[model samples]
Target: MTEAKRIPKRSEMDPKYMWDLTPIFESDDEWEKAFQEVKAYITQCQALQGTLGDSAESLLKGLRLQDQVNMKLLKVYVYAHLKKDEDSTNAKYVAYNDRASSLANDIQNALSFVVPEILSIEEDTITQFLQENEDLTLYRHALDEINRQREHVLSASEESIIARAGEVTSAPSNIFSMINNADMKFPRIKDENGEEQELTHGRYVHFMENNSRRVRQDAFEAMYDTYKKQKNTLAATLNASVKKNIFYSRVRRYPSALEASVQKDNVPSKVYEQLIQAIHEYLPVFHRYVALRKKVLELDEHHMYDIYVPLVQEVNMKYSFEEAKDLVLSSLTPLGEEYRDIVNKGYESGWIDVYENEGKRSGAYSSGTYGTPPYILLNYQDNLDNVYTLTHEMGHSLHSYYSRREQPFVYSNYTIFVAEVASTLNEALLTDHLLKTTEDKKRKMYILNHYLDSFRGTVFRQAMFAEFEKIIHEKVERGEALTPDSLSELYYDLNVKYFGPDMKVDEDIALEWARIPHFYYNFYVYKYATGFSAATALSKQILEQGQPAVDRYLQFLKGGSSKYPIDLLKQAGVDMTSPDPVRQALQVFEQTLDEFEALVLDK
Candidate 1:
């Protein structure tokens, strides 16, 4: 292959494989026009601020205009973000993204008066207005949700101060991102073939999944050794991020930082606590799975570095991006014709940026706006994981497509709370299809192992992180200091508890906390645990309950933020309030484990 062909520039790639942003904005000129329009809309919203309490018509008009401006802003922001992500090196797109973000803060500050002003009006008056102004009924639920947070709603100045503080508060994350992605470097390590491979953030995970113990260890140690040198810096950055959380929580009058964080999607504190509690009960099962890995790998003792390399590496399933598209679309047929057509269109219609290029974002995500087709950015690697990622992201894209097409702009977009369910459900379906079609016992065993590992990582492992976050926050809340040594000790103890005494917990594993960006996100990891449980239940229902379940799942895809996330999942037949789904998901994991052990052991 030509050197240029192996790694092509964004401009070198065919436009057919890239996402069509023109649907949202015909050109940069048009986008620039919309950008100016965003400023005009902000001024327009600001004009209606003080007059909101004057009449029902005024309130209704302002809310509708708010929706319009938000949608326009979303279009601008999503476009800029997608463009920036496509090629992070592009200064034009980066500036557009930065400008769009500033515009958001301006809009937020300008419209800060709307909520507090509406809250200033009597509840009965607002209700009567909604009753009198039939048009205002469109925003009735949205208004009610805002009204319900009256206790937390501060003055306009206070809200604007908080809004503006976002830029400053975001510094820790920004610093961490720059340091982790840009400044940090890892030394070259020998691959499984004994070839020296220079380690990058992107290659570290891949290196750990190598079949050779030496490669995994070298990669792990080399990665962490670098982190170890900067442990104090990372800990300080994390502490600042945590303090930012505490600041907002305290300012917003939330009882705790965790509450303030999950409150974004109206998730209850109990859901977060319940996830940790349930996972604590199942840690033994995860440890046993770890033991199973050690036995299968035929290792006398396996360290933390050995955890990632699959037990059954005999099945090397590599699908090109094109083949993965076909696999994803075929696997999703259970979702019915409508959803399948959307996936097919996405595959054919350049809705995805399918391959990696210089300066593109490293991870995968489905992003878009209320009116436009959702776009996915992926660094496709052609491995089994990449195939699952294709399905996962397509799951998100289809969810956005159905939701935006079916619901009004006001309720079109879903929250992150329910986002993971759609993504993970795709993986579940893809796993089912792969396992059912693959007759080879080893591949079947590998697929089963994949499912189990997914459950362990997503449900149990995230829950463990959630628990750690909770503990640390509580400590901070209680006037405790967070230093590198202190955080490491806490993290190491958690690992010991979670992984059990069977596996050797290496010293470098404690530094793993420093590497995780999610720790900076307060009380967010539990959602993945809960999302996995919900997705597991929904995927099972679709496979077994057939059309009826598919019908409900389709409803969920279209519901968006029309309802609270938990209620939406409840509509899809999973009650996240109870730990039933978590247990049910664990039961599935146990069953998969049993099958894999039976097959591999010839039992």
Candidate 2:
């Protein structure tokens, strides 16, 4: 086997092919100019508080000015941060990020008076103001949502303190990223040809895709060993983050940190509980899949590292970037001509920064604000995983594109509760598309394996993370410490519950919690499971019911944050408030497992 060439440095690329930042600002001088303007607007925000209640006209004027300032600030901050995230190692970019974050904190502090002051006004008075003003009609949804949370809304001074302290609260997450990306180093693994390869975030998936079991096990153990060494420090950082949640919850009069975090997005605690219950009820299905893997691999005992090695040894399908684009277009055709056209533009235009360079951010994401095109950053290589990733990010981009086109700026940005749905929906459709078109038996088995792997990772694995997050928070809420030993014990037990009898839940695997960044976003992992469930339902509707389902799903995409996330998903024909969607999704998982089993038997 030939050695893979060293990845090129970012500076070696031609400037023209790089992302055009001029749409955000012409130069650093222009960004600095806007930064100064935003600073001046902070003073303008301070002038609005007392005068807002003087008269209806004064209130309207104050609110409009506040919205204008906020919109401008968003444009400035989002551009700076997105640019910085592309190459975070650059000192100039890091400084830009830090400055923009500080400016955001300052702006939040200055504008904290707006919500409380609005809430202080009599509800009937605000109602009459909305009835009288044409311009305020566009803000009806925004105002109503704020009013709905009137009981939880804080006074201006209190909110200002909280807003200003945002960066300090994010310290744990920031430190985790710094250590995980910049400091952690894994041992080199010997490949199939006995050549040594250094493990990296970009190459981890490639290593997992290797046909050799030894290579996969070496890569896994080498990576986890590094994490195991730093477990104590990571546990401390995570504990600090959990305590921050508890402190905020108590300060805000919420019953618990989980309640406080979930209620912000209008999610019920029952939704979180239901995810755990549904997954627990369906553990048999997961165990069955694991058993099938064990049988196929002929292992006397399946270890944790054995999970990722492909069940089907031969995968012949290879997709170049252009081929992946065409596949995404074909799979998404059910969404209509306009949707397809927008996706085409994302590919043709410079909306995507494709491929990994020396300093590009690891992993994949879809990010943009209301003022810019929804830009996708991907570390693309020619494989099925990259194809799925492209579809997923495009799902987010097109959702943003449609939402911004259809709604006002205030409503264009959707919540995270609904954010993953579009992305996962695309993944579901892409899998269905591949399974339908492929004729060769080996290719069919590969696609089926891919589908099963997605279900396992997104639904099952994330639910495990969710359960761990909930348990740790409850322990903190009950006055228990989050030491490395305590956390590892909790994590190890949960792994035993999730993976069942077929596999060994190893001691070192408990250290896995330290490596996952999502835990920092308290109570956030449950949404991944719920999002996949909702997407499975929506995709089935679009494929089986056709045009009417397509229209409803499109409406949900365009709804953005105009409605509550559950209400928005209800319009798409999935009632996530109930557990039926999750049950149905798990049923689909079972069916896929059955297919894989039969495919293996036939071969």
Candidate 3:
């Protein structure tokens, strides 16, 4: 077969071909006009605070105006951000993003008093006000959730201090993104054809999928080498982020940073610890998979670089963009006609800005606002992986679409805790669909490899990162400095633990944490593992149990922020607080490994 066509240039595509944002704002001029209005309204919010507790009518009026201001501000912010992310290198777009972000901060600073002042009123009085005002019905859930956290609500002075310190607090994550995306450069690696290719985040996956072992090894080393050289810089950035968490937790009067961070989503620290414990108990399954990899590759030792190579070779399934869309539609039929219809609307409408373009965001995401259609940004190539990613991101878009349609603006946005479930469920269905339909042994093995890799990365690898994040946070909580040596040693030790006794834990791998952007999110990496586990359990329900299971899952999609994340997930038939879902998910992983071993080893 002829070599796959080279990736096309962005300039070759028409600008009009991109996702139409006219529905969001008639034009950039209109967006700017609204931006100015929002800037003026921030001052209006500053004046509404003292009036809030005066009377039910006055409080209702003030709250309604604040809601309007917030919705418009979010729209303006999303428009500027979506535009900038589509072309990060553009100077004008960069300015737009910075201005929008600054305006958001300004709005937050201005509205800081609203919550504190609201909490200061007698709880019974506010409850009476909610009962009295018809217009405030939309905000009842939002108000109740806030009131639930009343004890944690700080004094007005403390709230103002924290609001003003937001930018300084986010400095580490900001610096890390700037350096990693814009400044860091990786070494070149020779491709299968012996042509040197520059390593990029976009190309790293392609290199890792190379049929040539030498190429994969070289690309891995080349990518990590750059990270190794900048290890000190990365270490400092992560250290500051951890310290920020610790400081904020202490100032907020929480016993620990993990508690402070996790409690925001109503997640107990036990949930976090349960995930680690469940995955640790299944370490033997991971080691078995590693051993199978070494056996398949006919190697005495399995290095980290050897992890991604396919167990079955000579299996190529190329998909066009249109074909991928059809597959996504088929895979999602489990979600019911209404759910699938909305997805179809998204496809027919300009919900997706499909295909790669110069200066486009490196990865994929589903982003939109309460008043708009959920929009997706993807750098799609016509491959199996791209098909899965399309399904994945569209899962997010549809979740947002359903939630916004079913709930009010205040409850429209769901927390990240349950965000990945729909996306990965789509993926699981697609995998099962492919395996059941395809008869070719090599293709079957290829599909199985993809499934196993999902578990390996999303399940095992993220758990490892979660463990590292916990260790570093504890260090900071104990008043220990997270220097480069200390961070690297801690990360490297975890790598050794997860990879087991067989694989070689290269020294260069320790610097891996420095390169990961998730570390900047402060105790956020664990969600990937939890999300996949939940998705695995949910997918089983949908396939084996049919409409009843799907109805529960769809209820979860529509729940949004109306309920606590864990409570909402429980409504969907997966109890995240317990370790059963995670353990069951790992069992599925081992079963897949057994199937993969039987197929490849006997052949």
Query: In terms of TM-score, how similar is model 3 to the real structure?
Result: 0.95
Give per-residue CA lDDT, model 1, range 1-603, as digits (tens): 112223357898778678888899999999899999989876687678688888899998888888888989989889988887787668788789788888888888888888888888998888889889888898887887897688889997788788787767878976786567546766877777666767766566677778888888898889999999999999999999988999888988999998888888888778887777778887777788888888888889979998878878767777887788888888988988978887888877778987776566667789988888889988777677778888888888888998898888888989889988999999999999998888887788778887887887788778878888988898899999999999999999999999997789999999888988888767778888888889999999999999999999999999989898889999999998887888888888888888888887893
lDDT, candidate 3, 1-603, per-residue tens: 334334345557665447777888999899989999999997788888688888788878877787788889989988887887776666676678778878877887888888888898898888788788877777777788778778777887778778878778878987886677656766666789877766777777777777788998898889888887888888888888988998888887889888888988889899899999988999988888887788788888788788877777777777987899899898887778988888888888888888665556667789989898899988776678889899999989988988998987678899978888888888899999999889998899889989999998888999999888898888888889998899889888998889788788878788788878888887887888899999999999899999999889989999999999999988999899889999999999989988988888668
The candidates, ranked best first by lDDT, are: 2, 1, 3
47-74: candidate 2 lDDT, tens digit per residue: 8877766666777788778767777787
Q: Please report the candidate that would top lDDT against the real structure.
A: 2
TM-score against native, each model: 0.95, 0.96, 0.95
User: What is the full ranking by TM-score, best candidate first?
Assistant: 2, 1, 3
Candidate 3 or 2, higher lDDT:
2
| Candidate 1 lDDT score at position 591 | 82
Where's the lowest-lDDT run of ten residues in candidate 3? 1-10
Once fitted onto the true fold, the runs of candidate 2 whose alpha carbons sit more than 4 angstroms away are 1-7, 13-18
- lDDT agreement with native, every candidate: 0.84, 0.85, 0.83
Best candidate, TM-score? 2
| Alpha-carbon runs more than 4 Å astray in model 3 | 1-17
